[model samples]
Target: MAVAAAAGAVGVPAAADTQTAGAGGSQQSDIVTLDLYNLTDIHGHIEPVFDKYTSEAGLSHMACYLGKARKANPDSQFTLLGDNIGASPFTSGTQNDNPTVEALNKMGVFASTIGNHEFDKGLDVLKARIDGSDPTHYAKINFPYLGANISGMGTYLKNYRMWQSPSGVKVAFIGAIEDDVATKLFPGTVDSLTFAKPVPVINDLARELKTVGGYVTGADGSTGTEKVKADVVIAMFDNDVERSYPQMGKYVDGLMGGDTHKPYYFTKVRGAEGNILSAVASGSFTDNLANLQLKYDRKAGKVVDSAAVRIPAAEVKKCGDDPQVKAVTDAAAAKSESIKNTVITSKAGKFYRASQEDANHVKGENRGAESTLGGLIGDVMKNSFRTLDNRPIDIGVVVAGDIRSDLATDSGKITVGDVFKVMPWSNEINYVTMTGAQFQKLLEQQWKELDAKSSRPMLKLNFSSNVKYTYDPARERGQRITSVLIDGKLIDPQAKYTVAGSSFLLSGGDSFTAFGDPEVKASKRTVPNRLDREWFGQYLEKNQNVQPRKAKSSVGVSVKEEPLKDGMVKAKVSLRGLSFSGVGEPRVEKVTVKFGANSVTASVNNTLYDPNAAQYSAIVTADGIGHTDTPADVSARVRCSGRAGQTVHIPLTVENEAGTELVGAVQGLGVDVTCPAADGSVAGGGAPGAGASVSADKTPVKVNRLVRTGAGVSAILILSAGLLGMGLSLRKRKIG
Candidate 1:
């Protein structure tokens, strides 16, 4: 450590030689430069990976760059701001990111703050990782994990740490993880830890570091006290650059930020107290390096000026890989190489997980859209149990987050390593034998099952290829799912159906409370115990080649709730969510809309490489219905590049000339209809001779809400068709 301090003194004066003007005496140089290097949101990417960026920072390259910085400034130390590990690629994630810690140790990283992902396995595991106590691996983190504003920290964690520069300038790094970390994590994953606002807690600690050390409540639960000693304070915090709070300049000279993953640098941030601070943030996945240079006036006993920059480590070429870090990386790669390289399917083709692209062509995962990879995983989950039980699994579900990446290989072979990168968490699959009613609730829960919304407003769940559904976002939450069909038949509400999914989700991870409900799991048919990764591998083995499906499993449909006019029952309909927002994806070309007894075909330009959204508008007219009280169903069948979408029924009322809403409530997998109002205003009111005055522009006498008769879908579909066959004029057919 003494050599490290001395090395940092390169091109700097000794402490005694630099002290000047403190007592207004003859002065020497007053400045001492201290350099500190930082990395954030590395996300365990120890291996070199390439994408849109021209260059990539594998640990070896990053080490090389940091090595140069350290040689120039011997007092400098490498620090990580958080997310140094977790949510990793297969090379590091398979071994619980042990290699990442080993690599960091080899690089001589001084300290780090805890990222939200650090708590992915909970506090016990984090402590084990911090203290070299994990039973399976022996690689211990050689440095401390700091979090000043975090409560419930174990003994392995500290609030702040100290670093001394060669010119005798000591820096106190006070750390605070992002304040809203818990919202991004799974429920109950961080129940024991409480995160407070970072800026306020940081100010309080800096106050203590600069003044007398004393007893402070909640500083440590057991001791209720803490005292930090240092000459000046720096910040190691996880924060969004936009919300980093310039107020921190009041007590700290420089700030290091992470968690949002965007790289940034602020040369001068003026605090309320007129002090200036520098802030730096490095981009995610070893893409960038952040540096802070502080000029301390030893005689003045305070920081005078500071500058910071976020270096683009990826672009600087010709930096020879640091041998020590390369050795560590090589060992870790060798440890996971065998299984990762084991070929699962030689004939594997390209498959994609859904994503949304920005104007710059940068892609970010969009969990709201249905992905082909998600569909395939869903198939595997259900098929794994196929024929194993007397009754087949009625449905399978895949959470979008579980499929982390797309599948492709330059060698035309997909390996076990490839699958691990996509599904590295290794969540176990479980079957929940829930009632049909519960399934409906689960489907509606795609919007999140709470009155309050989540950061991601919608987390779309992918269903087995056999399942299809339609919804209307115009409807209120919890009542959005309009139709659900399995194998061309309506889902029976009271029927017991076995649904398979990962244990993480079935046990209520990601806010899916429907699967974790006690009543749903209470069914006698509920089953458990299957590895999701194992099933995926088995599926690849059995299928031999990957077949990509282009059609989306779900679509959005909404019909204007207006009265049917005259002999022609005309209603305008709006449809969307037909396009899959993925690379190399095709949009819907043709949509056959069937409403009530009328069917209409609309052209949607089903062409490959068309840079247009797949959306359509159409009108359905029922000319035969007079003023009866019967309700009708509306839905569409989408024709895409690969296949056709499901035609699930959407419930709608047949309004009368007086604009009275008809009673139609389809429950389960049936076309159930309720009786209309006694007034003749509703079509097919079934009231003795309902009124029949109809015009689109006519003013409505009154508005009646939808009525429910609770008729079974099977009986209604059959009876309606049979009645139309008899030419009884109960409903008319129109096609265009």
Candidate 2:
């Protein structure tokens, strides 16, 4: 009778109650302040970014937030939505996914669903990272990883686990990857398992809670007969952003997740009108935190007080005090220190900040603003792989978005911790084979994409390191690709080409529609997208002397011009940011000039502003090379010859002991070369920059200079370029 009464209290059928209960009636409360904390898509950015020297990163900050949530209310519950891994930066990727999990364990996450990135490194790597005996991968973790819709591995691997709060109320958490995990992962990563739609699997699990006779399911699926019939449902999923599901909010109490870079918090969801529903968004690669609070009542099953939203500064400080949180962060930091040298040394050029007005990094000959960082990362990953797998990679494709911070080649030491701060998640390596048709399709998409305006905002492919390919925007889309090769061998359109990529890409990330081509064939899987993991492993195994130094550097410019009646070319040229040494300062570097594929005079200015005149010119341009007067910086442009039918690409090859980290986006220019028309080809004209014009009526770059001669004696050039560039250079100067 008591069990029946308790079930009725929460709106559940009383007849289903089977457990006997004591007489003292359950306590009920009105105005329950359920604190719901949601942590979704934490790609291992565990640290906090306050300034340069003292930022905490990745699992540390997350753990701190969790500790704060626990204190905010003893009743508060923690949950994660999905996509806590894959496509992570060098830190977790290099480390094999262990330190990240250790930090999560310390954060006290109760439960989570599987996100697409979770499978990026392949299943074996995931398993080893999660359950490895080594301290790095499986040290922490007492929470449950629930996957209901995913079939296979019944007893082989566990399912959704439960976690009971101090109130003895149990929450059942089930995890699910997007139903398309097979396509997203290497063909074999999940060979032993399959996934199902998240909604049905979660609903079925929720119904089973009734079988416990009013006992709520807790972490590890343990059941207990509590007078309160409340159950907290946590579902983690990674799905296409286009497919909206209102039912998820209606059905679950809390959902913290990733896959989409956007954040979604306490917006009122429908089904939870009387209850509470919340979703946590992907943890910002930089600048953000999320929280979810869960509260229960005798009237409603489980209520989400708040979902994926930023934590107050006061709360951040509070969580920082937790011992468990600090420990996890320390471990990651320690592990990060191991691989810091390798990445720094592998950099061919230095990182320059990108302006808000400029396009971010991409993988072309010029490399754009993020090219150097991208190059260094690619080199490190490739080199690490070679050492581990005993094979050299043909080409490497790393997205520019993955590089969160500018590489500090100009005296700002980029440590292992710094690498971790920049790249925090773990994604393993996976290889695939694509037919000539598929390869051509991939290349064609890029050319067509370049021709279209904002057809895809998230398309920046950084192909640096040892990979080589040519993009002739002069040809029609799909046919623009003339050739594809591996190790200098010509690609046969009908034959398969082995390609290396992050598991995320193998499954198709960032709307890479080409990966799904029918002719593609995927190879075996490996562990870690986090380059740092492999870096550390290799360093430790080989125990070689690791030294960080800058490598290559170069400058590129893009100019757009119109043929006037006078026969002289009238055009606009943009001075892209300077690309410099990837690891150390350039031994000897100089920029060359060219005009319409021909030689042109080039000169440079070392100073952006003439203090004597108290005036500044658009930072000078050397002959054709844009070299800034600022030490270790170069940005300029030249008035070169232009021909109506000829377009030339000036390749700024920086030859040093190694590669340079000079990647700048060439904007303010357009390639107007006409391509041969093909059957059913889309019309392309007016160059890519049709509707844009030069608006000098803007104040985007500002300069502030300060001289200091002390222990760290330095002259700081505080040049506030655009937003991206602001994060780099500006405050620091290159030392001679």
lDDT of each: 0.60, 0.42
Q: Judged by lDDT against the true structure, how good is candidate 2?
A: 0.42
Candidate 2, residue 55: CA error in Å? 6.3
TM-score of each: 0.67, 0.52
lDDT, candidate 2, 1-736, per-residue tens:
0000001111111121112133222334422444545556666555554543223334555555555445544556666656665545555545655556666766666666666666666665555545554454444345556566777745324456555555545555656655655644545677777666665665566555433423445445465556333366566554422122344644466555555444334344544224445554433442334544444553655453543345422335434444665575566657765555643333222443221210111111111223445655555555556413555654555654455555454453345545554444434666556665565566444321311221122234544344433322222234323223344344445665555556566556544567766545334345454444345345323422333324322232333333321222233333223433232323233333322333222333322221111011112111111242322222222222232222222222222223322321221112222211223111233222322222132101111123222233222111112111211222221111
The parts of candidate 1 lying over 4 Å away from their true place are 1-41, 51-56, 70-78, 120-122, 134-136, 162-174, 177-284, 287-318, 357-359, 386-390, 448-454, 474-476, 522-530, 557-576, 587-693, 696-736
Please tell me which predicted candidate would have the highest lDDT against the true structure. Answer: 1
lDDT of 1 by residue, 1-736 (tens): 0001112222221222343232223334667667678888777778776654223478987887777765555556678898887777788888888888888887867778888778876777888887778758646787778888888876767897766555556677788875666655656777887778777888888877777543321212233235535677888877754345456757677778876444556677766477777777765677656677677787898878776654554443246588998898899899888878888888866667655432223333556567778888888877767533666877889887677667765555888888887787767677778876788788777774222333344677888888877665545556556666676566666677888877777776666778767876554243444467778888999999767665666765544433333323334444545545545564554455555555554544221121111111111000000111122334322111121121223333322223321222231222222212334223333332234322232321222222222231111121122112221122311111
RMSD values, in order shown: 12.0, 16.2
Q: C-alpha displacement of 272 in model 2, angstroms?
A: 12
